[model samples]
Target: MQNPKMLIVEDCPAQQLFAGQLLKQLKIQHISYASDGELALELLKQQRADVMLIDLEMPQMNGVELLRSIAKQQLCQAVIITSAKDPLLLNAVATMAEADGLQVLGSLAKPLNKELLSLCLSRRKAEVWPADFERKAPAFDQKLLRKAISEQLFSLCYQPIADMNSGQIIAVEALARWSQPELGMVRPDVFIAAAEQWGLINELTLLLLEQALQQLQQWHDLGVVVQLSFNLSPLSLSDVAFMQQLQHKVQQAGIKPELICFEVTETQDFTQLSAAIEALANLRLAGFGIAIDDYGTGFANAQQLSRIPATRLKLDRSLTDGVSERPQQRLVLENTIQLAHKLGLTLIAEGVEKLADAMVIKRCGINLVQGYLYHKPLTANDCTAVLCNSSEQQAAS
Candidate 1:
């Protein structure tokens, strides 16, 4: 498989050359450069780049204008770079783009140093591996991975969601995981994003869901009843054909309708409220439970909840972050939980990494909790073992 490509669009020839040389020094040889915004657009039209390094002040068609055009095309990923230190201009551009495709990788003043170069380069390769990743872990074999997910090389890890009041295993969130001979244990976020950009997200999601549903069916047969939540991309839901195929696959799996919940990312542009609501309502009518995942983090308002037919609200981790100290956030959480209850929707608190956070969530009356505090997402066998163990412990207590 070919390595991902990077495009450097800079107005200054000297800076462009410097960036190319730096990438070369880092052993990333597939580098392309553009002197101005118009040239960048022309080159991008012919060849798609995985990442684009753009300078703000270009002669014909400045960076902001170019970014707007790119957004319209949805062509290439863009990272803005500018010497402008004014917070107002930076905030305006960031708000306009909002990390959808346009991300501010780094801002370096006139003189760029090795540290800045390293930061930018590291950010570019972030999709390859996660941050703070240790070399002790095996590096991902991109070729093997591309073939594996395509040929059923991935696996499922179920993270137990415990009911705080009862301390009972109520539900489990299905997380996609992979372990190949070449790549010991691959992080799903990294490979999943890569798969989406490579136009394999639909296939990967179907495969993972198939495996997860089969396993959930087995658990159902064993009488261990619990809901299974699966994360889904906005694009996946937007495809009508894909949804039909998914419905067919789910029927074949024979998993109960109410037991499966499809979690849509809150980051997606739900600006067309009527269309989104219509789509979600259709899914709900089809017996697929709908949820607004990463709840408070997205642009969605409480009004959208009434409009959309989502059955559950998964609160964003940010709201629970530092809740012990941030009284304001705690108040917000209290209100959100109450609001969700008033709407007759189940509330799920996600990212419960700390015991204190989990405790806070329980006190806020959020019944379902999922995160590391309960147990990190585990393999299918491990999932069953955890559930069985939780049951045993409850009986003993």
Candidate 2:
């Protein structure tokens, strides 16, 4: 992070000079400039920089194309997109770059302020966060997969979800982790998809559920009472009998039904609509909460979402990552929160890594937030230790 070198790709000489001056004031002397992304790409091939300043409206090659090439070629340490264009467009471009597994520092609107630029520069992550937990996962076989599930080798970690107004952790969402033999940790997306294809999702789901509920009971006994959100596969959600399996487990663990919330991703289309709805309704009837996860992204429209009887709505990270920088996006989030309130759903903004993001979500009148800003996914022992610390503090007070 020291003496951070940067590349500025801009067609306008005056704009480039202004950015250069800002960097110079910041003490970034090792800087280079190019009139277009093509030239910038060529410069990067010659020598890469710690960060690249990209202009969206370049002539020869656009910023988006340059981003794709950089990601494919592994050029530069990171990127900060500068455009006088609409902030919404900037957000979309940032999303595009992140989707390609390229780390984006921040999107700066035109006539950029020095302080904002400085803030973005200071956010250079030492180790890049994976683009939505995706990777080229190691190959898995059905035999090995089934053996892992049966042996309970697949593990669970909990990410704390905080109540922003109170700054207290109100809930935790359970995420699965798997360390395949010899191959190390396998990405959840890959192994989960494999489980679904191999017709073993139910087995895997029950395995994690049992573990989560047992952990929740331990936390409750420690007076670290917080809600537990567990993701359910559609394959398990459609089977009404799955409700009974969950209920029996809850009873055995002695965790109240009200403390458990089942989360279903809205990004994927619900093909088994009727059965899934029936299961959800029954679960709600039994006092278990339902949350529409990843609400803004994918196939779940308002009409479809409204039909599901959800008790909570999780705004997808796509909508919140740059919420503080994008006024229009904040307006959208505020209206979405309004809609969720009218339907009696508690709202949570996910992937809140910056204080600015938390401020914007707080301004939007949503209280709950979840992401690396608060905590990463942690193992049961690690999480329970945090709970113990909080409990001791409360007792001391």
Candidate 3:
């Protein structure tokens, strides 16, 4: 890996000088500067920069437009938005850039100092650059998805959720896995998005739900009482008939609804808010737990939170990755935990990959922790073995 070439797009001469001085001090060799978005566009067209530092407020074409152009032309691999106007506005612009398919490293307040610049530069260095900026997934159609579902090509894996105080595995979350015969192991993110687009999410969700419930039933027969959590598609919540079917299936499985939790991702858009709420309420009334998944990484607002009768809030990985090391992240996590507790919701911290982070989460009063620190998602047999071993340990103790 050679030295990264950086481009600074700032209209203010003073700010440009400041950034240049810092870059030089940091021993950065190749550097470029653009007075405005127009100049930046021209410079980008001529040469490629590994990372770009952009000022939001600019004459001619603004930073937002520059980001659009960068994404359109596949110019820069990463971007950092620096603005003095308003932090909220800058963050919005950064979100827009991300939506446009640009990797937004982060946002920075203007009058940037060496410390902040160094942090941004280090982050940029740590990023793994792809071979191509505009790499697209191979086209997958509805037919392929339906075939995969019908053939039972999808599988479920369980990730344990542990109690912070007892340090015991109390529950497990079911995650869907698919390996396309041709595509090898297709990522859940890729196939899931495709499933939603192709209107096959309900079918996929039901299949996984049935599989998870059946596995839970087997565990129950083995005398291992552990809760199971499974992701629920928002689209399924709008259909009353589907909800009835779900209830019927649970009854047939002879599994208590209380042992199962339906996790609704916060990123889902509830076009029919009333119907969704009614469905969730019905599920809760029927004894199933409702969890707001990926709490801080979505479009869900306070109003939405108040409306949904969620029993648990799962913190997103973005907030948990470095909570113990980063003060800002720790503060955010603490505040979120406090808010959840005030609302009478159990907080489950996700992405606890480090013991230090786990200690911080436990100290924050979050008892339910889930992430790779405990275990990765396991196959049904493996999960059952874990539960059996835990039961044996308890008996021996």
Which candidate number would show the highest lDDT if scored against the true structure?
2
Q: Please give the TM-score that candidate 3 achieves against the real structure.
A: 0.78
Q: Ten residues in a row with the worst lDDT in model 1?
A: 129-138
> lDDT tens string, model 3, 1-397?
3467989999999999898898888888899999999999889889989889999889999998999998878888788889897665775676678667777766888788777777667655455544434555635677888999998889998999987676668899998998776667777877887887778888888888889888988898899999898888777789898889888888989999999899987554567888989999999999999999887775654555788999989887667765665566678778888888899998888888878888888898887889888878888899889888877877776
**What lDDT does each candidate get?**
0.72, 0.84, 0.82
**Predictions ranked by TM-score, top down?**
2, 3, 1
Q: Model 3 off-target regions past 4 Å? A: 98-101, 125-138, 162-167, 184-190, 193-199, 217-225, 266-269, 272-275, 296-299, 316-339, 350-397
1-397: candidate 2 lDDT, tens digit per residue:
6777799998899999999999888889899999998899889999988899889998989888888888877777588999998877988898888777767888998887789888888878766444533355438689999999989998899998877765667788999999976778888888998888788998899999988988898887777888899998877777767668878888888888899999987445367888888888988998999988888775655775568989999888877887887777788788888888888888888898889888989888888999998888888999888767765765676
lDDT of 1 by residue, 73-155 (tens): 65664464554445445444644664344444555554456666556545443443233233333355456556887689888
The reply for model 2, stretches above 4 Å from the true place, is: 128-137, 391-397
Predicted candidate 2, C-alpha RMSD: 2.7
Off by over 4 Å in 1: 1-146, 180-184, 269-276, 298-306, 392-397
Best by TM-score: 2
Give the TM-scores of the predictions, in the order they appear.
0.62, 0.90, 0.78
Q: Would you give me the overall lDDT of model 2?
A: 0.84
Model 1 residue 388 CA deviation (Å) reads 2.2
Ranking by lDDT: 2, 3, 1
Worst lDDT run of 10 residues, candidate 3, spans: 124-133
